[model samples]
Target: MLGIAAAVLFFIAFLINAADITTNDVFSSVNVMLIGLGLLALHVAGIGHGRRTGRR
Candidate 1:
């Protein structure tokens, strides 16, 4: 699922940030984290919309 993938990405990012594994800050930046959370929100919204419309 997208939410699971996003959570994995977030964990990876956290590890990368904590371990100083990446020289590029962009890879472990808050922007990337926010993007993952945005994906989760989008997924939830899609489910809500689907249920409301009764499309399945």
Candidate 2:
């Protein structure tokens, strides 16, 4: 569940970045990239938690 949430959040960030790039908003693009990276990290942490618990 947490992994799925993180994936969705990252996807939203991707969309935001794409929109910003299309509009030539460099600052917003960078911000979106940072947000996406944070979400990716969360996703990885969730995966680690599952691994530690021996759950698929």
lDDT of each prediction vs. the true structure?
0.70, 0.60
Error of 2 at 20 (Å): 0.7
Name the best candidate (by lDDT): 1
lDDT of 1 at 11: 83
Best prediction by TM-score: 1
- Stretches > 4 Å off in candidate 2: 21-56
* TM-scores of the models, in the order given: 0.61, 0.41
Candidate 1 lDDT, tens digit per residue, 1-56? 66776798788768777876755656665756887898788777674243354465
CA shift of 40, model 2, Å? 6.1
Compute the lDDT of residue 53 as modeled in candidate 1.
Answer: 48
Candidate 2, residue 14: the lDDT equals: 74
Residues 1-56, model 2: lDDT tens digits: 55555566567667766665454454464565566567668767664355365568
